[model samples]
Target: MTKTFVIDGKTIPFEDGQTIMQAASAAGVYITHLCHNPQFTPHGSCKLCTVNVNGRNCSACTFPASEGQNVTNISKELNEDREKITQMLFVEGNHFCPSCEKTGNCQLQAVAYHLNMTDNHFPHFFENREVDASHPDVMIDHNRCIFCTLCVRASEQVDGKNVFAISGRGIDKRLVVNSPSGLLKDSALDVSDCAAHICPTGAILIKRTGYSVPIGQRIYDHAHIDAVALASEGEAHDH
Candidate 1:
C-alpha cells in the first residue's frame, strides 16, 4: 500500500524522508517558494511556501509529508497572505523591475506575476545598499537582495566555499562577504560557481551577460513560473 496526503483535494504520494514540497512537485503540483533549492537543504525563511497542514500553517519546503495528512495550499485567505508577503519583499528591497537586468528571468518577479501582485502595498525602504563591482566577472547589487541566502548556502554547501554570510538581525539583517576587505573579489567565487547563479534576483549577476536574452523572449515572459520551476527541477538538482 502506498502512503499519501491530500493537498487541495488532490492526493499526493510521498516516499519516506520526502518533504511536502518535494511530494507536491513530484505530483506536478506547484507550491510557491523562494530559498528552496532541491540541491541544498531546505531553509524555510521565505515563508512563501506556507501551507496548512492538518489545519496548522507550516512551510511546505521544510514540513515532512505524513500519511493521510491534509494540506491546504489554495485558499482565499492563504492567497491573500502570500500576496502580502510578496508585496512586503518588494517594498523591503530596491527591486526596480524595469531597470533590472534580471527582470523577466528573476524568480521573485515571476512569483509576483503568478500571485497577481500589481503594486507594492507598503512604503518603500529605499535602502542605500552598495553595488559591489569589484569582481571582474560578476557583480553584487545589494539593494535588490531579499536576504533569501540562496547564494550563501550554495557557496557553503555546493562550492565548498564559505564566501557569503548574513549579518545583523531583524530589519538590520544583510548579506556580507567573507573577506577582510568585505568584497566579493576577495572571495573564492568564480563565474561558474553555484553561488554565482543561484540568486533569485539581480543581486548577483554575471557581468557582460546582461540583456543577452531580449526582454520579450525571457523565461517568464513566455511561460509561467510554475511550469518553468517544474521543468528546471532536474537541472537545479544536478547543479
Candidate 2:
C-alpha cells in the first residue's frame, strides 16, 4: 500500500519503511544533508539535513516516513540552523575554496552557497593535520575533512573492505585506516578501488587524473556554488 506524508506543505506519497530523505529525494525535494550518501548506509552523523518532524528537529536522512506524518523540510529556522552548521563546518576546516580541488562540485560548498554563506563567522581551530600521501594512487587529507564520515562509510559498507575506521572521540576524532601497517595503500584499497570513487573531496583522488582536468575546466572552475544551486533550482522547476 502507498502511504502519504506531508513535506514542505505538500503531500508526498511514499511506501512504508522508506526514510524521509529517500522519499524526498525520490520526490525531487532537495534536503541539505551530508553523511547520508545514497550509495552507503545512512549514518545521520553530520546532522546537516535536520528537519521538523511533528514540530521537532530530527535527522531526515534516517527518520522513517509514515502515513499522515507531517514533515517540514524548508523553513526560515531550519535554514538558519543549517547555515550555522555549515558555518561551523567552514570554520572547523581549512576549506579555502579557491585553493581546494573540490571547490564547486563539493557538496559542502554547494550547500554553503545554498545557505548564502559569504564568510565563516567563527574563529578557525587551525589544527595541524597532515595529508597522508603514502598511497601511490590517493591521498588522505584529514585537514580538509569536515568529519562527514562518507569516506569511512563508503570504505566499510560499500567497498566491503572495512579499511577506514573512526578513532578518538568528539572533536579529536579522525579517520584511521586498518591494517598491520598504518597506510591506505597497505589497506585493501587499490588504485582502482571502489572506496576511492565515493570521496566527495580531493582527499581521496585518483592519482592518474590529478591534473588531467585543466584548472579552468574543472568542476568548480567557472561557477561559484550559488550558480550551481540556481541551476538545480531551475531544473527542479522545469521538471
CA lDDT, every model vs. true structure: 0.92, 0.76
TM-score of 2: 0.88
Error of 2 at 4 (Å): 0.4
What is candidate 2's CA lDDT for residue 119? 79
For candidate 1, write residues 43-82 as lDDT tens digits.
9999999999998999999999999999999898888899
The residue pairs in collision within model 1 are none
Off by over 4 Å in 2: 215-239
lDDT of 2 at 176: 86
Stretches off by above 4 angstroms in model 1 are: 234-239
TM-score of each: 0.97, 0.88
Clashing pairs in 2: none
Error of 1 at 46 (Å): 0.4
Give per-residue CA lDDT, model 2, range 1-239, as digits (tens): 67889998887778777788877776667788757667667888888889999888899989999888898888899988999998888777777777766655577776776778787889998888778888887888777777777777877776778888889998888878887778776888876667777666556666666655656676555565435434554353345
Q: Please tell me which predicted candidate would have the highest lDDT against the true structure.
A: 1
Q: Where is model 1 poorest over a 10-residue stretch in terms of lDDT?
A: 230-239
